[model samples]
Target chain A: MKKLLAAVLIAIFSISALTSCGQGLSRFSVTYTDVFDTVTVITAYAKSEAVFNKAANAAHDELLRLHKLYDIYNEYDGITNLATLNRLCGESAQPVGKDIEILIKSGLEYAALTDGKLNIAAGNLTCLWHDCIANGTGLPTDEALIKAKEHISYKSVKLENGTLSFDDPKIKLDVGATAKGYAAERAAAVLEENGISDYLINAGGNVVSKGKKPDGEWKIGIQDPAKQTGEYRFIVAVKDKSVVTSGSYERFFEYGGKRYSHIIDLEKLYPSDRYVSVTVLCGSSADGDALSTALFCMSVSDGKALLKQKNAEALWIYENGEYEKTDGFKIYE
Target chain B: MNKKTIADIILVCSVVLIAAVMLIVTTVNKKNGDKFEISVGGRVYGTYSLSEDRTVDVDGLCVVRVKDGAVYMESSTCKGGDCVKHKPISKSGESIICLPNSVVIRVLGETDADAVI
Candidate 1:
């Protein structure tokens, strides 16, 4: 009788274990602030804290590597980063890394698609505005901006045989518009490669979602450009996708009671003001990043056509508080 | 019923009751929080209980206050007091970040969303 009771108890315990097999997977998160001049938060679900830590650390390291490669002002030892390429590529065809080669190729493609509105080669013009914003010295003079703009034509940037060269020595490259999103997408892959399938990488405003949780899809809140941070305009349910938002409100300087955003328009040689903000949902965060910035500089009709070409959906919020979203965007909501 | 059969039934019932209690405890624990966490420079500064109303000065760079089951930034030395102006966060995963000072105050519990972009 005693042996039979013991067997029954074992059977009950085994059944309970099988029923709660996946209960060990818990949500864990880590934050890093030293990359890309923004906050990077990785929230993931794993069986143990140790496993989550291992995966999150690997992702953070990947982000750091990409951050150093894309950095324009800072130079690190033993790495021929973008700054080095910018300085010497104008003189000769400089040997480049595969990451940079891919970035510049995609950047040039975006520049052509957007008619130079999203030009990575516009570093010369952007730097002038950057200096002004950094120093709080107000806006850059139109004279200096025009001179810098002349060096931005995409034809001047060349990449061949794993080498990058500039037709114009003065041409500089700024990946500000695309680097954070690209890095977030890469970091998400790093998490997956480390056996973390359920995760989300929020690199500032660029969010990349991997697999959904046991409960349901991840809910991502898009910030309202006219309101304060943490204030959401919409909450979208998604899995295995990227959502990126570009707004004139976050990084801007107030000059003469007017705001000049960081996203410059080559045609006007000033901040693009057609829309207050543009948010894009796509498979690649890099493409979403470029599209959001480009769409911010375009009209609603033109932006819709471009979104259709890429099969991406967008929500455009005009300066007058009116908003428009693509036909398919409502499905996520 | 036989004595052996009655004994087996009681054993299984007790085991099921214990498992249900354990599951309930864990689910409640994950969903509710009486504490909040503070991080600076991507490192956790400290965790404080929301049950106790107190003030925390973060490396002399900013001040955080816990009151009535909510947490908020009371003051900051950063150029913009955006953190101070932010609403008090009481729910899980709600956070207020002061970018310049690299200070973040977040409620400690399971969040509705995995993240906010």
Candidate 2:
């Protein structure tokens, strides 16, 4: 009985000691639903737990605000979100916030950047597939796909004096690809401006990391697309950089005895099977997030070329279980 | 007593009383389990309240239970079954790991820090 008592005491002391070691950093985090239909976690660092909580709440509020603004599905009163903007397509000039303008302008530029590989103009086509995916109605017909593709082209969107219009009447804008990344970048900046440099903002798969922990650099794990739950392919050490991953396997539906991924290809006008997943490390999460999808849909040679243009490092897991990476791609334990 | 002696006596009494009270409160609080978080691989699955006391099935491979304010890996289909061998967790930051299954259960409060790498 005495020995058992002593063991219990030892265990209690060890647990306390273990906790003290991690307590040095004073980390605060909040996880919420949606910025993009997945879980979003925001972690902030401060000298004390009290300070960390304040900053964390502020960060969460900021992200929630951004989530609502960029949302294409739902509408909130007094808020002009992407859904509303898209509804006004080719109609009277719709006024938008500065952030929306930034998203739209860059989205058009990104189309040019990837030589049209990353097409936001695929908006109307996406809506058609989106309805099918949501309702489990299976793939859209080839005729519908071909028609929807007509309204999709970066050049189809026209912006004049901060006003936006689409040349094609059927053109509908879906910023789903780049919106989260853009919001992540802007949210990180807001946290920085508020003087909290040590933070990590993960909006769905788009991550914008700023600063480091009190002990050392922040370590982030890359999720293995093939594995289910809690399985990570590897870890990456990052500070003041965003690491974003886009995996076609993340969301998929089976129809006609075959699976169709949500990540559609511009040229194929169907779910791309070029890569199981793509991870890109870059200065901006928006660029990295968009580029990861763009790269995933391209040939290895083309993906590598675009990664160079973005000055980003990437790792591509091919459909056949092959891995392709840029020369500068780095991973840590 | 003189003024200095009186002050010292009050200080000593207060410290002892506070320490004793804290020890009792903590011991009693341990009977009720706290909120704990579950994760698979590198992502958070959910945070559950231990006070509710219920069994949760983790996608069919494993079953987790929160009972009597404590959480534990009741069973798992993993070959090793090592996670099931682990003890129940009830305090902030305490964790149980099932390496074979890649499931981790941790008791957390406020969640002010970043999660596992």
Candidate 3:
């Protein structure tokens, strides 16, 4: 009977390790902005704060390393990143790192999965939009967008012998949508492998919660769409989940007193005006990031159709102040 | 002592260890008087106690006010000023972030650092 009681107690403790998993576990948070263009916060739990910091540093450094390798803008010691791949477009297929290779492969998979709604090969359209925003010229001329459509095919990318090649020299690959969240997922794994659980990794809008807080669930706030400035629409109680939010409110530029979002539709060669914000709840941050953007660009029916293949849920805030969410998604009352 | 007694003692020791750990963690993280940390560009810039009210000039671009046990943004350089619109934070782990300036302030309990790099 004593052994039986002890077994039951052990089972209960292991079941809710975070709730009663107290004592000996030190929880702390560290922020790093060495990459991802935005701040990344990872809260960790360990035997000691010093031990937690050391483990957190390892994860942060790994994210920085991935950032340098996956950067599409800057050349770090000429290591041949995505930008280099684009600059060397249509040339001989040069050897690339595994990170770039995996990303390209994932890009291809997501392209097919979302039916080209998420395209990394539409750099021409994205670059033109960037230039338009920088020059404050508002929307690009139809001629420019039409020209950009020519080089917007993901199929033009060629993978051979651990290298990548593009059929169209104008083709460029942009991984902005996937890089940050992918880094978060990777870094979170490092923390878990190091036996550090009960963490929250918020890389910009891409957030991943590993375990519950000692007090209770991790409360994640969904950014309010209607309100220009304030608290979130609602808080979500989550554990072992990834919450990624894509919104047009934060990143926008005004041209002729009209605000334009940065997300562009490859098919229309213009900004997608379907949704103001889309939050994807999934197991992986990479999927959440890409799917949030893809679903934001699609109609609800189409978004729901594609989401059937994956075990992920989505909540969409339409342009007309409407809320649409999957059945599994529940926001705080 | 008998073998059964020794086994019972081992189990008791394990339970005590876990209970002691729980006590340490709860006491260590207990919410103390108001203290908040200010971060710029993802680095800890300063930590201020909220006992006395003061205005913090954040690099001449933004101003933060700590008064009445609550901290809030009084002004900022960003056009959106979302940070300014955010509510004052006094609870532990609450944060206000300004993306344009890359500023983040989080409220925390009074816990000294074990190691600094």
Per model, the share of native interface contacts recovered reads 0.39, 0.04, 0.06
* Model 2 agreement with the true structure over A1-333: per-residue lDDT tens digits: 554455455555544544544655666665555345665667877667677656656666777787788777788898988778777766767777787888888888888988777888788787777777766786888999998887787796887777777776667778888888987787777777766788888776788888887546776767666654334667778888888888876667778888778888878888888778889999999898789888878887888888788899998887677787887888775
Candidate 3 lDDT by residue in tens digits, B1-117: 555664475567557666766776777566553789998875688999977799999888699999888899999998668689888877666677787787888787632211110
Angstrom error of the Cα, residue B14, model 1: value is 18
For all predicted structures, in order, the TM-scores are: 0.86, 0.72, 0.80
Task: Please report how far candidate 2 places residue A224 from its true position, in Å.
Answer: 1.6
Flag clash pairs in model 2.
Answer: A27-B112, A27-B113, A28-B112, A28-B113, A29-B112, A230-B40, A230-B41, A230-B42, A231-B41, B33-B69
- What candidate 2 keeps of the native contacts, as a fraction, is 0.04
**Interface root mean square deviation per prediction:** 5.7, 13.0, 9.2
Which whole-number lDDT from 0 to 100 does residue A143 have in model 3? Answer: 99
Candidate numbers, best TM-score first, in rank order: 1, 3, 2
The list of candidate 1 runs beyond 4 A from truth reads A1-22, A331-333, B1-34, B77-81, B85-87
> Once model 1 is optimally superposed onto the true structure by TM-score, how far is the C-alpha of residue A188 displaced, in angstroms?
1.3
Residue pairs clashing in model 1 are none
Ranking by lDDT: 1, 3, 2
Most DockQ-accurate candidate? 1
DockQ of 1: 0.36
Tell me the docking grade of candidate 1.
acceptable
lDDT of 1 by residue, B6-51 (tens): 6677677667766775786477547446789999987899999988
